[model samples]
Target: MVTLDKDLASIQEVRDLLNAAKTAQQTLATMSQEQINKICEAMAQAAYDNREKLAKMANEETGFGIWQDKVVKNSFASKFVWDYIKDMKTVGILKEDNEKKIIDVAVPVGVIAGLIPSTNPTSTVIYKALIALKAGNGIVFSPHPNALNAILETIKIISVAAESAGCPKGAIGCMMKPTMQGTAELMKHQDTSLILATGGSAMVKAAYSSGTPAIGVGPGNGPAYIEKSADIPLAVKRILDSKTFDNGTICASEQSIIAETSNKTAVVAELKRQGAYFLSTEESAKLEKYIMRANGSMNPQIVGKSVQAIAQLTGLTVPASARVLIAEETRVGHKVPYSREKLAPILAFYTVDNWEEACELSMEILYQEGAGHTMMIHSQDDRIIRAFGLKKPVSRVLVNTPGALGGIGATTNMAPALTLGCGAVGGSSTSDNISPENLFNVRRIAYGVRELEELRETPAPYTETASINEDLLVDTLVERILAKLQ
Candidate 1:
């Protein structure tokens, strides 16, 4: 692990960074939109040029996610800068009419303090840093211990680019060593204007309670519900593709399945065809005993391993290409660790009698870990899908694709994001997929009620006098009526 003199950079260092950032923000905000676009284009190109190197750094430092997947994540992050904000104009006040009515405009919040997760360190660092820069804010990152190297390396890349582009010299900074205390100091520091937290529940909570406004997200326990109407074979293929992607380290990956009973057998068979090895009841029990703690915390060693790797742990031999290991879910709750976030290639399947049952089971399982995360469904019936969306407590309900890829925008039309906001129900402030645009505010133009005569002729009923004390009239009317009746 890298070491730094913690006492040296203290809270004061963050303050100094903020001061420089504010000056740069003013400069960038004053610059033409053309300049910002040029930087974004350059960023996208840099991301493409260095994708391989960034991916390798993530894999070596985090030791959890795969390199190829990290590459995709970095590319998405880089491209998203263009996708979400490339066309947006944030430099000058937008005007609707010559009535001195200027629309809303975004101003950089000075300094941003971000907590980068170990799961997607490199991508998160790049995404947050670039978005902050684009919004004309200065940023500092506290990388998770598992990904310190990748985080630092990415910082160097971004800082060099920004400085070369004539941005502020210290527009971006990162801690050389990030400890628990160091993180606490950063979040609670007075100069840190906002906290963009992406990680576990504990860190999100800390950010929220740090006496600053924060955008926090909760844990993801994504549940995929397969209605009887879904194509059993296609659904099976999508599920396997999702679960085994990056060995299931994705937070949006399906943690449990609620398959309609009529399709369970067919789905299981197709899953077998797609490189899944089902364990016998006895073997599943033994594997459970060895792979999880009594409290259901996954054994870290088994979390991101492939199915073949997990099978080898249980003295079972599987083909080299086996994508996922499976076991029948006889019951529910924390006792069945696989039904929760195993964060590996193991899957648990539960059978339901009907669509309603499937929805209930899926929501129940998600409520256990998802809370505010998301629920996924596959069915041709739009009404049924809408019903699930309306009834479920989940924040973002996805349909007709693998939970992992669909939720993160890989195989769907939705925005590609690494951060899936688990809304307040799940203890998160965000309820949509994370995007660079979320980091900034949109300016709106409002015209005064100039047409008071037209407003009076409108449908809404209101006494529109040139000067009306509505409150005084209500009180006077009440008194007059009471006096007359007396």
Candidate 2:
């Protein structure tokens, strides 16, 4: 009897998928912009139509988030992402400037290696597939083992639609038997051009360490600041809505709320009014041990779990009206679990003396974790908003909107995307929202505007005993010639 081990089978499957993606990408590179856009449109439509079904499957398979919220995420990926990129030019000539004598040509980055996380299974797959095809690149997805079936179904739906609309036969692929060894093979494959990594720190780190170019997102512990000049009720509503959406699975969701001491009472009252349950000191201490494991990473028991589920896990009595769990804290560090990225409906509340204190506290929180991910500021004072925007290490500063939705460009105009790329400060290649523009490289077809002598021209140094400055002479002649021509 011949029995293949799971790792060996996964590795073999990854190799085959990589080869197919490579061959398909070669054909994709020759596609016109119109052809690529049509295929992408079809894929987006197909995914959007199956959004609900896929969302349900993701929830059932992974037990991460609500199926309804997953539907919204799916719709954002399919419709919002498609609308933003439908008119984009990703193939052939992109721009031409006769005056500059340079033409920008879009070139696909070859086969892409997409690593999907269990947090956002179907939506991530659909979004990656759209942007990859829009840029005329083929992609192979390595679905997280926890959400394999849902991810596989998503890939099948979109890939079939793409192929029906003139895409290459194997332009999009997914691994049914995902393993660490298989993922390694996919990232380090000879034909793989880029790795679009969206997962845990270990997996993202592995992608970067695979000796391949990767855009890997880091952990997000964004602080939503409620300045004195902000709308208290509206700000609280936005924060609660964002943090509770999909149980805060999105990395960009707010992890903490910073309120001014002057408005602390009002903020707390409003939070309670809006279904926020504050845990006492004892409760916070008990829950802290459960938030992070002994390994110094997030505890899976609480990740993407609801308030009721989390209370049950922690053996605490929570109100049925509680939409989110709040813990008052005065510290920020890895040791302080409330100050870190929980990735669930658990939020830390901090009270500061003023907006300046809020700013410094927010920076401290981000420095500890999620350095270049996102932050939220709700304020009518443009000065304060601008101040926070200037020195923060975060890539995006969402204002007066739900962090989860706004970060993905649903309620905001930032490029609609599911994979939010944290900047170099967070160890990502780009500080973008991960769009088609990030998927392709540009080839500049430039004309030789300067002669060899012009290139050799050097500015003569200023001195008392020297010949006329060559730069001065050229400038004076050029000005006179221009005047005469005019």
Candidate 3:
């Protein structure tokens, strides 16, 4: 309810925050690994401890997503980040050498400026702050106006742990108030060595194009396709769980469903079983036009409405218990506002007669909202999944699971995260979930040709006679051996 004046914080305030972050980065560089781990653990514990409070804050502030699901999101950010970086060596001295020759090292990238979104405010607040700390970098946060209070409070909790662990004061600094101009200032600040940006297209674009280097995430228009081979019932159950969770505020949540005509009936039945209510043809036609703008953009008013609420918005009557509002098969690229990430439990369905049609329509739907985001297909057919993955123009193609949670595990078994990086077409550099590893840098030590022998003086490539000549060879022989030396 508190609206921040754009001028609440001036240029001087931004300067102070930057100075503190720089000091914190230096402090981190001098800290021991034990100190780093202690601080990280404290952050993880604080997130877990305040899960309920954090969820409440997010729901009340954003008026989007369910509270319980936000709890899971916050907990995931804390625990997953800690586990991902636990074994990662970022502290003290990490030296790769030939026997003992210095090769590559791990170096922190100075100060990081992070932009937290309204959708997953507290989770991202903790996640970005912790990752920067893990990398021995100081961090500054620009919270979305909708979730500023939640973000600032979370930062306070983390600052306590960081300072107690001997981290330099101001290691984790955030603006008491943020504005369009203020955020732009932070992004362009020379003191901010790195930008970790998440949110709308304009913000991400600014971060990427700002002379400073940044890791930017794009918008998500994840589409779920169900082929003939899929278990219609199971797919429906999983899709409903993913779509309805947190009122579909997640960027990776399923935006559209493409199912085979043969399985449409069965899928719809299961969807109903999972608390979804299917609308009549007339109802869908009315809602479709109502939810979308003439230009095809989603109407913001419908962004986070519940299934039943959306039904009412279209002049239909559905029980309050309904978790998902289903609109029957529509043409590909149909401009229904409902398909454009309502951020709610409303699902737009498309039925195709053949796999090719399904693929084509699924890609079209994804392109409509997320040209470079994520698409998922639930099927046992590797060929189908492979086809979708290779051809959809989407950054990520998840198989057999919902786009929101399952897509995060596309490259690793890491916990399903809230932040997804929609790639180029989707207007992002990443095609997968953003993780802490992205925040760190890998410093390489290249030796001059003359220095190569000296660098590897003590290390023998191969013990055999043939090996000696092999080691002398460049491409595979030398490079492979050097790679193994690490």
Best by lDDT: 2
Per-residue lDDT for 194 in model 2? 97
Give the residue spans of candidate 3 off by over 4 A: 1-8, 92-102, 293-297, 312-314, 332-335, 410-416, 448-486
The candidate that wins on TM-score is 2
Tens-digit lDDT string for candidate 3 (1-486):
885455645455778899888876887878777888788888777877888898899889877778898888788778866776777677655667775455666678888889998888998888887777877888888888888888888988878876776667888999876877777788898898889888776788899888888778776767788898998788887788788877887777897787787888887777878788777888777777766667655565666667766666668888777888778666555455655666667777787898899877776777777777777788988887787777887767777776666765523374345556666777676665665556667777765446666776875556546434434565667688889999
Task: Please give the lDDT score for candidate 3.
Answer: 0.76
- Model 2, global lDDT: 0.93
lDDT of 1: 0.75
* Per-residue accuracy of model 2 over 291-403 as CA lDDT, tens digit each: 99998899988988999999999998999989998999999888889999999999999999988899999999999999999999999999999999998999999989999
* Model 1 spans with C-alpha error above 4 angstroms: 1-16, 94-102, 290-296, 313-316, 442-486
At residue 102, candidate 1 shows an lDDT of 50
TM agreement with the true structure for every prediction: 0.86, 0.94, 0.85
How many angstroms is residue 365 displaced in model 2 relative to the true structure, after the best TM-score fit?
A: 0.4
Model 2: how far residue 252 lies from native, Å: 0.5
